[model samples]
Each structure stands twice: as structure tokens, then as C-alpha cells.
Target chain A: MKLLELSGIGKRFGGLNALTDVSLHIGRGEIYGLIGPNGAGKTTLFNVITGLYQPDSGEFNFNGKRYRAAKPHVLAGAGIARTFQNIRLFANLTALENVMIGRHVRTRSGVMGSIMNSRAMRLEEKACRDKAGELLNLVGLKKPHQTLAKNLSYGEQRRLEIARALAMEPLLLALDEPAAGMNATETENLKELIEGIRNAGITVLLIEHDVKLIMGLCDRVAVLDYGRKIAEGVPDEVRNDPQVISAYLGVDGE
Target chain B: MPNAHEAGIFKRQRRRILLAAILLVLPFAVDGILGRGWLRIVDFAMLYIMLALGLNIVVGYAGLLDLGYIAFFAVGAYCYALSASPHLALAFPQLFPDGVHLSFLIVLPAAALLAGGMGVLLGAPTLKLRGDYLAIVTLGFGEIIRIFMNNLNAPVNLTNGPQGISRIDPISIAGLSLNATQRIFGITLPSVHLYFYLFLCFAGLVVFVSQRLEKSRIGRAWMAIREDEIAASAMGINTRNLKLLAFAMGAASGGISGTLFAGFQGFVSPESFSLMESVMVLCMVVLGGMGHIYGVILGGLLLALLPELLRHSVLPMQQALFGKTIIDPESLRMLLFGIALILVMLYRPAGLWPSRVRRRELSSDERPDETA
Candidate 1:
């Protein structure tokens, strides 16, 4: 079954075309990789999918239901969540508290119930804590649950962001440049983390510049050039595609 | 593990009891040693603590800058004055031939609801605004409310204009009026002491409510929004509703404190709710430590007492130094106070009682960039 279907997605900023006629589809639980050269609109596509920007002329479907525009929280409610290209963790909040916030939409304790803290509220709170702890452990962060997000190592912050997103229980998770600043060892760990996320039955859509990681992990690869999808196929076919090579290395080999 | 847990609980219980005992005996101890004037300062400090906690919900937890929070306090005071006092008896004599006097319980909630309603009203249109723009709008809202209080008397005689409303009924429990002295077991308790105890109880309640909020799911949502609004929304937390909730909750506390102020002072006026007063309350929240409850309370106490303490000591020092008052101590006090506050901020930017997370963030803020 198709988890997400986008057709003719177009977005513009004044005179600049950020994304144009971007059409794509991904089946449930597939690891889809999006690769592009600089200014190829990779992050813009993620923003559009996550409802940060409204597509000027396109409709997308989630679980076969069409939507033209929805608020970020509404998209999240419909099982769509994404990590930012820049890390956006709640810097002052404890790591556990950060993930617990992602658990907010799933829980239903209103202001009065929270203030009163009845049996039901306490139970829900305890359940949220346990679930968040499990997610933290899944992300391989252990024994420093109380540490602030800003205090976490660069690699741990990336993993913690994923954990926070997973706390939302998203059906399709979009990770934007998950291995931006990681060394080879850290990138190896991220590969396992993304595969683990897929093994858990969640669809993974990722944007990455690291060709090795993308070619190694993606079940299917899609390449974009100047806001247009130049090629799409299995990892090997797209990696050897002439159009993708010229787009990455430039037509005149500059 | 069980023994340690049980011992922790026991230690906490013992500390709570000791604190409660001190609080219970505080008014009498002050009355016996320091006299009534000083006790009144303590009472006002508690009231400001409630206001600071209320403002903390907006400025601290939710990260919305509100410059006009004192407007909610005015709304609350007016709500009580209109409902339970004869200030509007002549204007709406048909509704209350003898004036609609109500019990303390009735007007307290009424005032809170009224202020909370006003909060929503103000918050709805300005939901998209943030940072300095939000501050400007709220500051305007506060001034607008004050202007209405000053001018509403001419057209409707509702707020009695700048002359203000007087003769407000005192808060009472069951049948005992807090305004009147009571003889309990042949020991005459002064009315001021009664007011102090009542204010203390309400302050305790506010503290409890604030602490619960800081640990609850809703509190977590607010903090998330405070940290990163876009990421928070992406996590399925509704930013709009949470911001409104912060405003309403904060205003609700202001309303409660305002009602208490009306009852204790037995009067209400525009002068009592001014821009300076709003800034003073906000200062308590910021200087005490923006996101920490204990920090806010400590800030409130210190700021409230500092002026009174200055009043008592500044004149004596001046008299001894200059043989007479060379400059108005009030003016000099502001200069010294400003310098002291600047020094404190320079020394401890995270505040004297910062939340652990806030302290960590502030400390790390000075370090060189580590994240690539």
C-alpha cells in the first residue's frame, strides 16, 4: 500500500522556484533515499511534506486520503513527522522531557486534569514516561537521561532528535541530513539506527548527501537537480544514471 | 531500594511540617516583634508572589512576553467591586436595592473567570504575534484597561472614574469576617493578622498549583513551545491552544490576587494597577529565575522587601552622613537599586535560584562552539 503520494508539488519564493513539479510515491515500510546536489530543493521537499510550507499547486495523499494544506500539528496528528536539517531539540529541557513532549499528542490530559492529577492523569503520565524511556533506550542513549539536549554530544543529539520524533508514533518518518556532521563511525551507527527504524515497521524517507550511506541503505533512490527529479530507480541503476552523475559533477565537469 | 524510598518520603514529610509550622506562626511572630506596618509589607509581598507566578506562566514557561499582565489584576478587582460592593448600587439600583453583597468564595472564582475571559479575548487576536510585538500589544491592552477605569465613570459610572471604588466588602469564611477582629479562646486576634493568614493560605495554594503545572503534561507542552515553536508543533502539540492556555491560566492567577488585594485594602483604584507595578511583577519573575518556581518566589520576596527595607534604612544613613536630607532618599533609592540589579545580573545572569536546565544553558552559552 502507498503510504505517501505526492503529485505536481510546486512551491516558489518570489522569483526563485524552490520546488517544481515534484512527484513521488513510496510504499509502506520502504527505505527511500532522496539525494541531490546543493540547492536541489531536498530540504524544501521535506518541509512541504511535513506541512511547513503549502504547495502552490499540488495535492498529497496519506493513507489514500488527499490533503492540499494542513498545519504542522495536524500533519503530525495524521502520522507524519520530520526532523529538521538543523537540529531543533529543546536545548534546555532534559532528554527524557524532550521525548515526553513528543508523547503529548498521544496523551489526553487537559489543564484541569493535569492540575488535579487524578488517578487517570497519573497513569497516563507514568505510561508516557515508560514509553519515552523505551524510545531513548532504542536510540541507544543510556544512563544520561537527565542530561540537557544542548549538553549531549553531536551524534547523540541527532539520535535524540530521532527518538523525539519516534515518540510521536509516526507511520512515515522523514529525516533531513541525519548524518550531516558525523564521522565515519557515527555514520555507521546512524545506518543501523535508520535500518532499525525500518525493521520496526515504520516507513523511512531520508535526504542525505553522503553517497556511500545512501547507496548502501536505500532500497530505492531518487535524485533531484535544480528542483526537478532527474532520475528514480533502484539504488544501483540511479547511482549509475548519466543525468544524476552530470547533475552532481556538473555537465562541463566543473 | 524500598528503605531508601521510604526514608526519602519521611524526610520530605518532616521538612513540609516544619515549613508549615513556621508559616502558621509567622504573622503572630511579626506582629509581636515588628509591628503591623511591616506585616502589611509581608502580606503585599505574598500577593506579588502570586502575581509573579501568574506572569511566570506566560513569560517564563510559555516564552510569551506580556507587558500588561497587571491589566488582568485590574479586571479582577473591578469584577469584585462590581459584584460584591455598593460602587454600582446607584447605577444599577434595580438589580440590587441594598447592593449585591456575596461571600468570599463566590466573588473569588467570579473574579478569576472574568480575568480569564479577558485573557482569552486579548490572546485570540494576537495569537500570531510573538516576542516584542506581543509585548507592545499587551502593554497597549493594559493601558487601555486603565484608561477605561479612569473614564468609564462619566458615561456609565461603572468604575467610578479616577476617584475609584471604595467600601469593598472584606473576605470572610463561613460567618467570620476577615475585616473584623475575632476573639478565639479569649485571645483577641487582630484583623490584619487574619488577612495575613488568609493571604498566606492563598499564596500556598498558588505555589501548589504552579508546582503541579511544572511537572504536568501541559507544562511539558508549554516548555516545548518555549524551546522551539516549530518543532513543538511538528510533534503534534498545538501551539495556538497552548499559548491561550498560558495566558488564561496566568490571568486567572492575576484575578485571584487582584480580588485578594481589593478585600484587604477595601478599595480599588487605577493608581494601584499601573505600568510600574506590572514591570515590578515581571522583574520578580525574571530576576528570581524565569522558569523556576522557587526562583520566582525568592525574587518576589526580595524585590518587595527591598523597597520597604530601603525606606526604613536610607533616611537614617542620609541623616547621619549629610546632617540632613541632601537628596530625596526615594530618588537615591532608585539609583542604588538600579546599580544593585545591574551588578546582580552581571554576577549571576541565570538568576539567584535558576532552574537547573536554565543554569546549564546559560553557563554553556558562554563557552566556545562545540557542535559542528
Candidate 2:
């Protein structure tokens, strides 16, 4: 079953067409990878899907609900959670607090409840703390839970961000350059983590510049170039497509 | 032996107890040391602490810069003034034939709600504006509210124009006016002392609410918005609703405190709620530590007392030294105070006690010493 589907998507920034006629779909529980070169509109596509940018024209469906232009929070509530190309963890917050904030959509406590600090509110808060703790452990942040997010190392911050997103418990998780600053060991850990997240029944949509990682990890691959889908198939088939190659290495005559 | 972590927690717990105990008796201690005039200063200081705690929700937790916070204070004050004073009787006449004077209990919550509603009104239009533009709009809002209060006398005489509303009824509970001194359990207490204790209780309540919010999911959501609104929204926290919530909650505190201020002074005036007062409150939040409750209270106290301290000590010293006075005491006070604040701020660039994240971000030199 398709968990997320985008069709006829178009986005523009002034005179430049950042993305045009971009369309794709991810089956439930599949690790789908998006690969493209610089200025390929890969991140822009992610932005359009995540409701950061209003598409010039397009429609997307998530869990059978159609959205022409969903607000960011609405998309999140509709089970689509994403991480940025650059990490955006609440730096001042504790690693645990960052994950707890991710549980915001799940938690039901309101202003009056929080101010009153009733027994039910206390229990809910404890549950949130416990869940946040588990998510941090899942992401392999073995540091103290009270460690501020800013104090985490580069790779740890990346993993913490993923933990925060996972805490949202989205049906489909979109990660943009999750291993951007990671080294060999950290990337290996991330691969295992994504697999773990998938095993937990969440479909994954990934954008990575590291072709080798994408090739080894993705169940399927889609290539984007010049704001359009150049090629998409099983990882091996998409990797062998001539258009995908030409997109990566430009056509010589042109 | 427990680890270093356990030791740190133990120490913090002990320190918290000690701090609470000191805060309990602080007013009486100040009264004994400096007399009624200084006690009045302490009372006003508590009110500013309430305002700072409220402003902290917007500026510190949600990371919204609001320069028109005093507008909420004015809204609250005017709300109480319009409903609970003879001025309201004069303005409406038909509504209250013999002059309406309501209990403080009724006025306080009414004013808070009015302020909260105004907060949402201000928040809705400026939702898209960020940073400096947001600050400018809020500043304009503050000025506009003040001007409205100043000129609403002719057509509808709402705020009594420049002369201000006087003889505002003091807060009374169960027919016992807090303004009157009564012998309680064989000890005679001054009316000011009674008001001191009452204001102390209000400040304590504000502290408790703030501390609770700081630990809960709502507080975390606010901090997340402060850190990154886009990321916060992406994480399923509604940025617009949460921003409005911050403004409303912050304004509620200002309103409640303003109601108390009116009851305390027996008056309400536009001069009390000014742009300069807004900046002063903002300074307290920044200097103490934006999100840290204790830091803000400390900031409120020190900044609130600085001018008074100068009036009593610095002015006398300067007069004695120069025979008459070489410089205007007010001008010299501003110069010394500004220089001192800058020096102190330079030493602790983030704040005296900034939230852990803010402190870490501001002081890169201290980063290498810590581990992840």
C-alpha cells in the first residue's frame, strides 16, 4: 500500500523553477531513496512534501488524505515527519527534552492541565519522559539524558535529531542527508538505525548524497534531475539507467 | 558512594530549600533594614518580577521579541480601573448609579482575561513577522495603547486622560480590606506589612506556576519553538497556536500583576505603563537569564533597586564630595549604571545565569572542557 504519494508537483523561486512536475510514491514499510546532484531540487521536493513551501502546482496524498497545501504542523499531524539537511535539534534543550518535544503531537496535556499539575498531568508527563528516554536509547545516544543537545558531538546530534523525529511516531519518516557529517563508523550505525526504524513498521523516505550507502541500504531508488524524475526502479536498475548516469555526470555535448 | 551526578543533585536540592527559606522572609528582612520607603520599593520589585516572569514566556521560552508587553500591562490596569473604580461610574453613569466598586477577587481574573484576549489580538496579525520587525510592531502597539489611554477622555472619558484614575479600591477578601491594619494573634502589623505579605504570596504563586511549566511538555514545546520555529512546526508543534498561547499566558501574568499594582497604589495611570517600563522589564529578563526562573527574579530585584540604591547612597556621597554637586545626580547615576551593566554583561555575555543551552551557545571557550 502506498503510504505517501506525490504527483504533478511544481515549485518555483522567482525566475528559477526549483522543482517541476516531480512525482513519486513510497510503498508501506519500504526504504525508498532519492538521489540527485547539486541543484537537482531533491531538498526542494522534500520541502514541498513537508509543507515548508507552497507548490506552484501539485497534489500529494498521505494515508489516503489529499493535500494541496498543508501547513507544516498539519503535515506532521497527518503522519509525515522530516529532519533537515542541516541539523535543527533544540540545542539548549536536553537530549531527553528534545525527544519529549517530538512527543508533542502524541501528548494531550494543555495549558490549564500543565499549570494545574493534576495527577493525570503528572502521569502523562512521566510517560512522555519515559518514551523520550527510550527513543534516545534507540538512536544509540548513550550519553546522560540530561546532556544538552548542543553539547552532543556532530554525529550524536544527527542521531539525536533522528530520535526526536522518531519520537513523533510518524507513519512515514523523511530524512534529508541524515549522514551528511558522519564518518564510516557513524554511517554504519545510521544504516542499522534506519533498518531498526523500518523493522518497527515505519516507511522511510531518504535523500542521501552518498551513493554507496543509498545503494546498499535502499530497497528502491529514484533519481531526480533538473526538477524532474529522471529514473526510478530497484536500486540496481536505477543505478544502471543511462539517464541517471548522465544526470550525475552531465551530457558531454551540452 | 553515590556518583558525582548524585552529589550534584543532592547539592541542588539543598540549595533550593535554602533559597525558598530566604525568599519567604526577604520582605520582612528588607523592612527591618531599610524602613517603609524601601519596603514599598520591594513591593514594586515583586510586581516587576511578575511582569518579567510573564515576558519570559514570550522572549525566553518561545523566542519571540515583544517590545509592546507593557501594552498588556496597560490593558490589565485599565480593565481593572474601568470596572472597579469610581472613574467607571463617572464614565458610564447609567451602569452604576451610586458608583461601582467590585471585590479584588472579581477584578483580578477579569483583568487577566482582558489582557490575554488583547495578547491574542496582537499576536494574530503579527504571526508572520519575525525578529526585529516583530519587536518594532510590538513597540508601536505599546505606544498606541498608551496614546489611546491618554486621549480617551473627551468622547468617552475611559481612562480619565492625564490626571489618571485615583481612589481605586484596595483588594479585600471576605469584607476584610487588606488596606487596613488589624491586630492578628496579639501582634500589631502595619497595613504596608500586610500588603507586603500579600504581594509576596502572589510572587510565590507566579514562581510556582513558572517552575511547573518549565518542567512540563508545554515548556519543552515552547523551548523547541524558541530554538527553531520551522523545526518545531515540523515536529508537530503548531507554531501559530503555540505563539499565541505564549502571548496569552504571558499577558495573563501582566494583567494579574497590574491589577495588584492598581490595588496597591490606589490609582491607575498611563505613565506607569510606558515604553521605557517595557524596556526595563526586558532588561531584567535578559540580565537575569532568559528562561531561568531564579535568574529573572534576581534580575528584577537588582535592576529595580539600582536607581533607589543610587538615590540613597550615591547621591549623598556625591553631594558630600563635591560640596553642592558637580554633575546632575540623575545623569551620573545613568552613566555609572550603564557602564557597570556593560562591564558585568561583558564578563558574563549570555547572562548572569542563562539557561544551559543559551550559556553553551554563547560561550564557545567553555565548550572544549565538557564532554558529550
Candidate 3:
């Protein structure tokens, strides 16, 4: 069954059409890939899906529920979590604290409840900390107590972002260019991590410039060029579609 | 390992007891050595600590710059003054033949709630602004409140205008009037000493709440917002509500402090809630190390007492050295205070005592070279 379905989604920025008539259905437990050339509105589509931008026109349905997702936090609360392209980790917070913050959407404690420091809040907080630690280990990050998010290595920062995203226990995780600045080995590790995320029963929506990683990991891929989907199919079919080839290469066969 | 952990807990408990003992004797000690005037300064220090801790929740934890924080203080002061004093009775004598002198118990929480409501009013319009822009708007808000207090006399005399509100009732818990000196067990308890204990208890409660907030989910979410607002929202933190909550919380503290101030000083004036007072409170939060509780307390105590300490020392020192009063003591105090602030910021950009995570962030800049 489709975990997230979008139909006729359109976003406009003044005179520029960022995304037009974009529609895709992401099934549960599938690593869905969204690939495009520069200025293809890949990130814009991600933003619209994540509720950062209000869609000029669209029908958004997630997990059998229909809603506009009015705000990013609302989308997050509804089990849709996302990470930024440039890795927006809380720089001054520790690795554990970063992930613990991600657990905020799942946890329900307000100012008074926290200030009261009730037995239940303490237990919830401890459980959150333990869960955050487990997620860090899953992402291969150690010494979370000692290291700030800003002090982590580039590759480790990417993994930490993934851990932070996972801390929400999201049904669907949207990642924007998770492998943006990685070497070959790092990309390989990221590919495996994405697959691991899919195997964990969470749907994955990924936008990456690493074409090989996308082709290797995604269950199905959709290709967009100039804010329009040129092709949508399994990896091999999308890789060979004539329209997609023309969009990526040019009709003149350059 | 367990034994070491137990030892750590034991040490912490012992330190807590030692600190408590010091607090218990602090007023009497000051009274015996320096005089009752110093105890008043100490009382004011406790109030500043509450103000600093409140502002820290907004500016330090949530990274929202609020320069109009004094407005909330003013709101609280006026709330207490109008409610417990004869101002209401004189203005609307039909409604209150005798002044509406409500119990202190009712006024304190009422004032805090009023301040919190005003905080929401301030926060709603300024949600889109941030950084220096937020500061500018908040600065305007502070001035606006003071100007209103100054001019409201013509329209309603609600705040008594520039003349201010006087003869406000002192705090009395369970009919035990703190305003009057009482003799118990042949130990004379001065009004200043009574106020010190009351203020200390309230300060301790503020510290406890602040510390509790700094570690919980709300505090983490606030820090997340401070770090990156968009990321925080994406992480499922409702940035709008959280930001407003921080403001309200901070304003509530300011309100409580203001209520106490109005009672302590026996008057409420527009001049007391000036832009300068807001900046002074912000300085305490910044200089004390923004996010650290103890650092803020240290900052509050030092700033509150520094001016008076300078008053006592600068003129006397000049007399001892040159045998004459040459440089003005007040001006010299301000000059020294300014210089000290600049030097501390220059040396410790993060803070005088920064949070551990912040220290790592400041020092991590040099690491890229090593990694490369």
C-alpha cells in the first residue's frame, strides 16, 4: 500500500515554476528515489512534501490520512521526518542531545510537565536517551557524550543526521542529498544505510546526486527534468527511458 | 565505578548543605559587619537573579533577543501596585470605597499571569523577526510600555503617570507582615532581613525550575530552536508555540520580580522600567554565561552588587590615596563597569563560563585544518 501519495502537486515562485503537476506514490518499506538534473525542483518537491512550502495545487495523502500538513512540525508529528541537504544538526548540542531533540515529536511533555520533573517524565526522558543512544550506534557514531554535533567528521555528520531523523520513529523518512559530499566508500556506506532503513520497515524518500547509489538502492525511481517528471519506473527502466535520456543528455545525443 | 559515582553524589549533597548554611546566615552576617543597607542590595540581587534566569529562557536557550523584558517587570509592578494599593480605590472609588487591597497571595500569581499574557501579546507580532531586528522591536516595546505608563494619567490615571504609584502594600504571607520588624526568641528580625529570606526562597524556586527546564524535553527543543529554527520545526518542535512559551515564561519571571520590587520599594515608577534596566538584565544573562544557571547567578550577583560596592570603595580609596575627592565616584563606577564588560566579552566571547557544548563549538573551528 502507498504510504505517501501526491497528485497534481504544483509550486510556483513568482514567475518561476518550481514544480508542476508532480505526482508520486511511495509504498511502505520501499526506498523511493527522486532524481533530477539541476533546477529540476527536486528539493522543491521535497520541501512541498515536508510542508516547508504550501503547494499551489495538490492532493496530499499520507498513511491513509488526508491533510495539508499546515506546518513542518505537524508533518513531523504525523510520522513524516526529513533532513536538510546541508545537514542542519544542532551544532552546539551533543550528538545524543541532537537525537534526543528529534524524539521531541514523539514525546508529549510541555513546559509544566518538564518543570515538575515527575516520575513519568524522568522515565520517558531516560527511555528517550537510551533510544537516542541506540540510534547513534545504528548509525555507527560513538562517544556521543563527549562530541558535539559540530565537532563530528563530515561523513559522521551525515550519519548523525540520519540517526537524528530516525529518532522520530517515522513511518517515512525524507532525506535530501544525504550522500552529497561523500567519497566512494562513504557513498557505499550510505547506500547500505539507506537499505538498512528500508529493511527496518520504514519508507524512505531520497534525493541524491549520487546516481549510482540511487540506482543501486532504490526499489523504484522517478526522473524529473525542468520541474516535470520525464519518467517513472524501476531503476533499470528509468535509467534507459528515452525521455529521461533526452532530459539528462539532450535530444541531439550529446 | 559505582563507588566513585556514589562519592560524587555524596560530594554534591555536602556542597548543597554548605551553600544552604551560608544563605541562612548571609543577611545577619551582612547586618553585623556592613549594615542593613547591604542586605537591601542582596535582596535586589536575588530579584535580578530571577530576572536573569527568566531572560535566559528566551534569549539564551531559545535564541530570541528580547530588549523589552523590563516591560513585563513593569506590568507586574503595576499589577501589584494597582491591586493591593489605594490607587484603584481613588480612581474608581465607586467600585472600591476602600482600596482593593487584595491579599499578597492572590496578587503575586495574578501579576505573573498578567505578565505572561503581555508576553504573548509581544511575541505574536515579533514571531517573524529575529536577531537584531527582534532586539529593535523588543526595545520599542519596552519604550512603549514606559511611555504608556508616563502618559496614562491624562486618560485614566491607571498607572498614576509620571508621578508613579506609591504606598503599595508589602508582602504578607499568612498574615505575617514582612514590612514590620518583629522580635522572636530575642533575635530582632529587621524588615531587610525578612525580605532577604523571602527573596532567597523565591530565588531558590526559580533556580530549581530553571535547572529543571534546562535538561528536559522543552529545554532541548528550545536549544534546538536556538540552534536552527527550521531544523527544530522539522524535528517536530512547534517553533511558534515554543518561542511564545519562552517569552511567556521569561515574562512571568519578570512579572514576579516586578511585583516583589513594587512591594520592596513601596513605589512603582516608569523610570525604573527604562531601556537601561533591560540592557542591564541582558548583560547579566550574557556575562554570566548565557545558558548556564550558576553563571547567570554569578553574573546577576556581581552586576547588582558591583555598583554599590564601587560606591563604597571608589571615593574611600581616593581619600586614602590622594587625601581628596577628585574624580566623581558614580562616573568612575560606570566607567569601570563598562571597561570590565568589554574586557570580559573580548576574552571570553562564548561567555565567562560557557556551557560545555558551546566551548566545543567555539574551539572546533581550528579542527578542520587538522582533519584536512
Model 1 clash pairs are none
Model 1 lDDT, residue B192, Cα? 87
DockQ, each predicted model: 0.70, 0.63, 0.74
Per-model CA lDDT versus the true structure = 0.90, 0.87, 0.90
What does candidate 3's lDDT look like per residue over B155-228, in tens digits? Answer: 55688898999999998889889999977679889899999988898788888988999999999999999999
Q: What is the interface RMSD of candidate 1, in Å?
A: 1.8
Give stretches of model 1 more than 4 Å off.
A252-254, B94-97, B185-187, B320-323, B360-372
TM-score of each: 0.96, 0.94, 0.97
Which run of 10 residues does model 1 chain A get worst, by summed lDDT? A245-254
Best by TM-score: 3
* TM-scores (chain A) of the candidates: 0.97, 0.97, 0.97
**Residue B8 local lDDT, model 2:** 95
User: If the candidates were sorted by their lDDT against the true structure, best first, what order would they fall in?
Assistant: 3, 1, 2
lDDT of 1 by residue, B57-130 (tens): 99999999999999999998888877778877777888777666888799999899989989989988888898
TM-score of chain B of 1: 0.95
DockQ rank, highest first? Answer: 3, 1, 2
> How many clashing pairs per prediction, in order?
0, 1, 0
True contacts kept of 2: 0.84
